[model samples]
Target: MRCGTRWARSNHFRSLPQRPDSMSIVLTPQELRSHLERFPRVSLGYYPTPLDHWTQLEKHLNRKGRFYAKREDLSGLAFGGNKVRQLEFLLGDALAVGADVIVHGAAVQSNYCRTLAAASRKLGLDCHLVLSRAYDQPEDQGNFLLDRIAGVSIELIDEPLGAEQEARKRRATERLAAAGRRPYLITYPQSEILGTASFVGAAVEIFDQFQGLPSVPRYVATAAVGATQAGLLLGLRLLGWKGHVLGFSPLNGGEYAIQEAIWSGIRAVAQLLDIEPSLEPNDVHNLADYAGDGYAKVSTAAVDAIKLLAQTEGVFLDPVYTGKAMAGLLDYFQKQKIPPEEDVIFVHTGGNTALFAYHREVLSLL
Candidate 1:
């Protein structure tokens, strides 16, 4: 039942020949699921999300590289997004531990909070959301609307970071505990490990889809938020995928801190799976330049990128995360950072619901 030992017994391990390269460990989707079965996971999002070729997008870009999109957007929960995957393990842990209330903190229009609110309702658990403000906007829209619709108790805080926000979330947890309610706090350094583990399963799905391609992808790109990027990179490493996994920052955090967070998640996942950590510090690649005007603020390039994808590929990307990441991917191609013939897979982490909050900004692109 150990990590490496269990992997060795899987059909994928027995069937596929080991590569000559250093990445010899590989796990198929089925094997990966089997390994993950040991963990507590409540079924949340739809699995094995669409992996389709973005031929129109490639044609529009007039680039030599073939482009594919792994549609995590269609993950199928509370309008669907990357958070659904993370919530699977997170809420599962809550229910497993007899938690009656779920507490988490995020931005005013956080897709994470929206998804968590819906998930808490579905699991029949009381949901409490601590919304931290980064701007002076007083309007409640987009994911915030959905959060309210889900009947989650909301606490708005002026502090978005540092000790103040942490103190607020801690006090909320204490209040719930005082009422004899078991509360599960989903915050960094606590829920991130389980949250990241969900995307390890996602990587397995990506690998399986690549098998249909004439050639394997050269790169996989996604917006980095520690958990998403970290889990994906770790899963790809475990699967022995040779492609580069690039994380484009959607927040203001510098590359070093982002990499550290990702690396921490990777180590946590490795420990959770009882496997030897194969990822190194260098493997945590992040592009910080695409963050634009900081967290949740859409830049001109991101707005244009959002428009282009919608016009050409009929795929909607949110102004916050995916649009910024798409802008990074476009910049990479324009700068010729990736070779001409190589294929790239972009992970659409999903935030179309948040587009409502930035309707004016996105419409201005036209």
Candidate 2:
């Protein structure tokens, strides 16, 4: 399906005011909140996560601009991360559909898997995890260790592709059904749309938090797997915000493929909200140059970025996702891609707990 075509013909969507030439379309938080309330969402994390100013880090970099962090790290889930926001909607949908068990697939140390396992326990539901050895890490460390401690059923696969992992989850769900259990699969491909809508709510929060600032942010940066970036982009679009959203990829997909995935999510969100897709193809920006070796691998730049943030701002970033995204943000600043005069916001989509798994690599950086 085309990215913006799905909801383009809707008369209700067409009646909405066009974005002004100055790009200063004002949308109140309450309006967005009203639309979001139409869907069922369970509280999974602390709301209105702090928007912290990183003055020391900005000073260290000698940036003549403001640097702010949206602390989704302090989200207060199992270990707290962006996944908590997604899980709120995902698990709520599961319960709404009368599901008795939850199924998800990711790397062995996936924060997503860990958080989902914890959420299932809290809700008194069973969780089944399909873990892949895609990162070539130890069997028991970081989120994997937490998974074991949570006592969820787990199935291990050796570096399965996307389709392979889905098939495994499908089989597991079938078995659960046969055993007289209702299963809810939280896999990325199927559930991203619902999970993504959470961040649209997040975007409204960010915009409202910055209302009294001296100047609004010129850009918002986040680690991109499509869901987070696409949701935030759609939120900004629906809110009529003028700032750009930059996504830094942690994996090897080139810019085009990443943009395509993000656009697919935008299309989904537009359909979900029954609104016109307000973004163009060029509006989705994904920087893949900073991925370094690959996903879940340590890199000098990411290590340095992690250390710098911790040392200067007392903030911790995971090597896999946020660290690399921060590296890109710093690089953009140094290269003048982001002009020094413009303020920027980095969404700290938390993964500090994963640091223990890469202790050796992280220690060597010191």
Best by the lDDT measure? 2
What clash pairs does model 1 have?
none
Off by over 4 Å in 1: 1-24
Scored by lDDT, model 1 comes in at: 0.80
Worst 10 residues of 2 by lDDT: 1-10
Runs of candidate 2 exceeding 4 Å displacement = 1-26, 254-256
Q: Please list the Cα RMSD from the true structure of every candidate, rounded to 1 decimal place.
A: 6.4, 5.3
Tens digit per residue, CA lDDT, model 1, 27-126 = 6667667767756789988988999899998888887778999999999998898989989987876776678898888778888889999999998999
Candidate 2, residues 1-366: lDDT per residue as tens digits? 101112212322345443343232345678777766655678878988889999999899897889999998988989888889888877776776678898878889888889999989988999989999876877768989999999999999996547788788878888888898888766554366766788888898898888868888979999987788988988887787877999999887742377887888778766655567467889999888888988888888999999999899888999889999999999999899999989999999998877998888888886
